[model samples]
Target chain A: MSTSEGTTSSVKVGGLTLEVHRRGAGKPLLLLAGEEQLELDAPFVAELARTHEVIIPSAPGFGHSERPDWITSPDDIAYMYLDLIDVLELRDVVVVGFALGGWIAAELATKTDRSISKLVLVDSYGVKLGSPTDRDILDIWTSRPEKVLAAKWADPAMGKRDFSKMNDDELTIIARNIESFARFCWEPYMHNPKLKQRLHRIKAPTLLIWGEKDGVISTSYGEGFAKLIPGARFAVVPGAAHYPQIEAPEAFLSTLRGFIG
Target chain B: MDAWHFTEMPYPNLPPIDSLSTMRVSLPNKLFDPKIGADLYNRYLDEYMIADDLGLNLLCNEHHQTATCIDVAAPLTAAILARQTSKGRICILGNPIANRGDPLRIAEEMAMIDCISHGRLDVGFVRGVPYEIFAANTNPTTTVERLWEGIDLVVKAWAPCDEPFNFEGRFTQRRAINLWPRPYQTPHPGIWITGSSDLENIKRAAGRGFVFATFLQPHEKVKWMFEGYRSAYRDTGLPGGGGTAYMPLVYTAETEEEAEKGAKELTWYLNAKAEPQYRNPPGYVPVDFNVNALKGTFTGRTDAMRAKTMEFLKEEGVMVYGTPDSVAKQIKRLYDLVGGFDHLLMMQQAGWLDHARTVKSMSLFAKEVYPQIRDLPRTKPLESRAAAE
Candidate 1:
């Protein structure tokens, strides 16, 4: 399917209806979004769909998805998405996740065997590489938006938003997204303390994608995350920070496609 | 009505207002001078003792990582007051149980306070303000749930169960749920949940037969909230409003002008201390309610109301400040407007109000204002209206 061919739909899994965006008609590739707004129609998603059927489901508590009260942690989301995969009857799927989504994907890989053929964690969070006192991820919640943007993007200009022009609906969507993000990631900061040990349980061939200029979580931390997973290849997309897929789409796609192919 | 003396025990000597946008959450600890804090704690305790001696119920509150309120732990303050004050009830309004990693510890601590106070403890549980979510590193989305769960666990722990039982809660879990030094009050000390415009919270308090105490909201808003509580209580088949309380900023002087002049100190508290960003972080208030629907809501109206003058505040019944007679009349009017309250949590010392002035105001209110309004008829619940007909 082409970029314009992508359609938004909903699927009921485990009594909760999840909004899923699907495109293309080849091998299944589940795209998990980060803490920010899930843009399934982004150029990167469309580009990926050209080769494979891209399935993007808004995580529970995000966008138009249903957030059951018990869905408060990434582990819970991992199970939910795992159930989504089973319900859809998708086999040999490639799981691609970004930021918090990446963290969820990592958790999913640990839980699934033979179901997910490959895993890609782009600037993911779910490991403790440093001492308890050391911060692996810059605290986006407490810091100023400009500071958060600076840490999140190689070119801070790309992260700029003219919030004044946003209508109440748009703003409410943004607020809801943030509240959902906080629900999942607030306590224990961004990383699960035990995920480092759990990384070894993942059987899928994994790729650790880090932005060269990623200041939010240092490349060193990415290296540490890669080291935890058995035989996981580490790659960096240059001229990008936390979101290389957005900041440097060509570089990110080249890295992603090279691994998944 | 029972009059309770309350203070945040604010660290009066603050750095330049420009240096910090807010006193809570992200405020640097280096700005906190332990030497000054030591002196302030002693002085604040002295004030509480004086209030106790004057036959006022002593109320203490807890906040984390904020110079705005230096009283970091309510149980500690309650324990201190329990030992010091003889007659006054030690009302800790309250322990922010949602932020506490272990809610059972609160049960243990409050139980200890009750034991120390010799049956004079009133446990008030609060969800705490928004910045506390940041300070305590708690999930804001789960605040209300955690608060209720914590309260349940605390109450259970305090109950006279001969055998240790298991408590499996979403926010808390313990295999052996038992508290040492059970409270002096049978079952437990009276549980009070602080109320705002949150209808669910008001209903929860009413259902649990806890005192629904509202603080600092405007008179009209308080009236609506009390009515909501009473209605909820009636839904639970209770008579009257169960127990209702209102906390208001109060100051009294020899004359009206002196009172107004002194009350101006609260403007610092209302405007400068609480920055909007810190006070109302995302997910602090539920997003289900449309933003437009909350335009004139109680908590939403605070910032605009904060900028108003003493006269405006007095007129709104957000505060009462004047001579003893005038203050008494204001209290009476507020009581009538809100139906009736079983208790009044009066904030006599706020902002940079000096200790001497606070003592003077407290003395005057106790001697003059207290007598005039203490016997005023309590407001009947909306159920009373149905019964009257």
Candidate 2:
């Protein structure tokens, strides 16, 4: 059991609640994110939130937040979160999403209100993977994460695990991540079958941050995002993967910090 | 012309801070931000990689559909941490065994991460949250059974013995299977369990001498859970004795106000973000409903008496808060209130708190509270091993 510095309950939205824990003060900079269970409260946003109120909401069905039954696609998560944007009545919100959430931000970017200050997508998907999508990403959850991420990491060191020893909760986290990953990366495989064509609809000034070594979506895909989104600028993070945020957070954030700010 | 317009904003550029606390990522609640998300994840990867420099344990987990939890939706999430922090543990308390067509597949993946991280791997298991059942189209009744059966198959697979391992159950069917290279650790790597009937899981873990952990609730509140497990040990139904683990989301800072400021958003944000998934038929507890119940959630079988009990518990330090020193005091008090805990896994960088705030909390605790408790049994340092080749 932990004491004072431990545990915070979920923040309520509608009848449901999403786990949000924040520190630092400033303009309400709403953050939409993707991946990783926040086990600790060591967020990298306080620097940014210090001058801005950072509002980071876990996508519905993640963390302490409820997974509404209506959400099934990146678009669904994006549109649903738009509710939060409205509810909080945040203005000039700097909407930033990574990976899956980046995909959602892109979807909503096309439809969100003028309150959006800027849109930054980090290694985002939800668009076509250039030519036709090649490798089937649907099998990722049940298959090897290395294989699932084989395309994302240039240095693929896929290791194996023996799940037999894990307790139910740990196993559940693994299972849920895989299922959710697949749910978002389904059909067109990370890239939306139509999201590429829809890029023209987005109005927010977009910044695309891609990891140089990202193997999942090729560097070519980043090119696609840059080319497709009106006035979208692209930057490559060195020594990173599909998850540049995890692999090269500084470069990723610097590139984004400059563009968003 | 939509109303959304882009404007130049001063996004906080707060630099990382120094500290020694458990290495874990703050899973923020924000689903949308001014900046794109891929950027944020990319940042997490880089920052988490620096955890090795901070001498902290790097961590992540799995949550599908829900926005707050994201790590390895699959076991491969370890690959990121494995490369970032060579010596720190790369844990995956995941792979809802019940939802899978074959749980052993996760075993294979975890084996891979374990190998990649060398011996520095801690594995925890969760039976998948209730809603995951609906999301995966799997039967909840069968998921739990599959979880146990799947566990049996995986552990047997990990054992050094080459003996044929057979597991045939309602959810999974596995025959003799062998995985090469196994895990880096002998007889597999470190194993942990989270959230189950406190008595049943803790006693079983104790007998195996494995790590036991739980989430939510303050330390004092967790005392009830530990007590249930201790009583299980007292029952002496098992041979060896008792074992329990506690993993709490803590925010420790220099001053009480700082810690509260560092951690307050989490309490408020959790309520804010969890609103979407609360509706599950009438009887289901609304997500926020628990806050009121938390004040009165315990011992409420009888309306009036339960209300009175909640009022009493709330006053009796049922939950705790404050500075590193204050936190130390609260933890010590709870330690005395309940049978002391073996280890404390702090997920301080969680919820929507900015990474800097979370790190500040760690810095404060490392400077103040941690030095005081460095000698705790759970805080011992294993000789730092070189990164696996």
Candidate 3:
């Protein structure tokens, strides 16, 4: 079960087997990776593991996880995570999600009353907050890699990696992750139409973290998402794009620690 | 072999290819001029009518958000053609059922077209090209399964069974699956499936006794696909060569030099209109298929073909264009190369091939080429042929 950086284990959630990476010691913090490339051993996740018991599970059809044929949408994954929580008998769980995972976290929070103690959404995607002509979320699926990277990162240079150096296995995993993400988020387009109305059903204390320079989804979207959830706090991590934790790890962790503490 | 005239119904008047990376999926709508679109639609319809007059089957295809193809709705065009043409079989090659939210709607539309055409309707189903999955916002992972389920639902809906049936598919579900007006043709219209080197699709097409079409691939790849289809049909205990069809980009004129001059538009279509990234978004084709492509085992198409010269394409038999006699000879070579085919869907119009030239090519192909190759021996059941031998 032990990997190079962390110990990985498989947990049966309903009919599917999900791979979870466990590290750190204190209170259980369920870390949900984003739609793009489910990297369990990312530096940000590693940094968070130093303080809390970080349980990062690769969503179905992502990385080494087993995706059941019926698991098509984000709601399915949300329910699966809820089942994962029940199966693990985990209590007072602080659920943190990034991008697509953030949308899933919001869904998971609405479904449960006590299992999740707190919710942290990092540059989340779920709310539609603009005119019909306005593009709320960047169409990353069809865009060029450099354009997507430019939108996703505070500095595109940070995200640029020589893909040619990667072997076939690495490329295959990347492809699978992208495919799985598309499977979950392509239709209804990274947001649920009913999610805005259902935000009132969430029982946990919520924190909306926005990367100030996020080009994928604007800060206004993050603010709107916060406004919908009752008793939710909105915080901005400056000098970062869609993935603040990746671009500005120190600022992101400090903000997270302040909210979780 | 039966001849069918096909076009992507391209909006040829557009900005340079250097200005845009692709013609599909992400192509800006600002580039589309409604006046031009209005002219093109009617002009394309006129071309279809001309093909019908010349005694050729009419073929139309659908693509979403693309200048490469203005036929956004195949059934709509088929419905129009049904009302317009009398004798020619209107073939929609075809509606991308996987992208559609409801398969029953397709069943209803096709049935309506059949009723309008007075039973001369050929239903051609396709998994669609890669970019279409993105354009329609459908999941590629489940496209093949969804396509099968959709076809099954459509077929069941069109069946003559009086009792209402229910369909609970993995991708779609419905209660009381019954279609009104049924279809003009009993047992529904003839089903055809277009594929390019996807063996699973070929098998599905052959197993269901649906016509198998290989479009826009090299001749060697088409030959391999035809062999696969024949083998699959034999395995299913079906007779004949799986009702195989091939659609190649074609242009013909009075002289070889004139034909070659006209064929430049096709070169533009091949090089610029067929952008690789737009044609193949991630997860559109299966990972295994791509891997096989990389290993040189799968010979359908590669990105490198985009850079191919017109002469190279002609040499490769990806295109057939010349004087009437020369074109006829080349088609015969193609027919022999692929063993035999039931139909030949010739794309006489592509890129910016003007209406006049398109008409000329269509007229020439109908008059000269069709007569020569129409009676070529079609592929028969491999098992039976082996027994006779």
Between candidates 1 and 3, which one is better according to DockQ?
1
DockQ of 1: 0.38
What RMSD does each model have against the real structure?
3.0, 23.2, 3.2
Candidate 3 lDDT for residue A60: 92
How far out, in Å, is residue B252 in model 3? 2.0
- Candidate number of the best TM-score: 1
Give fnat, all candidates: 0.35, 0.00, 0.35
lDDT of each: 0.83, 0.56, 0.83
Put the candidates in DockQ order, highest first.
1, 3, 2
Ranking of predictions according to TM-score? 1, 3, 2
True contacts kept of 3: 0.35
Q: What is the lDDT of residue B315 in candidate 3?
A: 67
Classify candidate 2 by CAPRI docking class. Answer: incorrect
Mark the 10 consecutive residues where model 3 chain A has the least summed lDDT: A35-44
| Candidate 2 lDDT tens digits, B68-109 | 443426465567677557755665655677666576677777
lDDT of 2 by residue, A23-95 (tens): 4466566566665432123335645655666666666655545665445567776666676677677787887
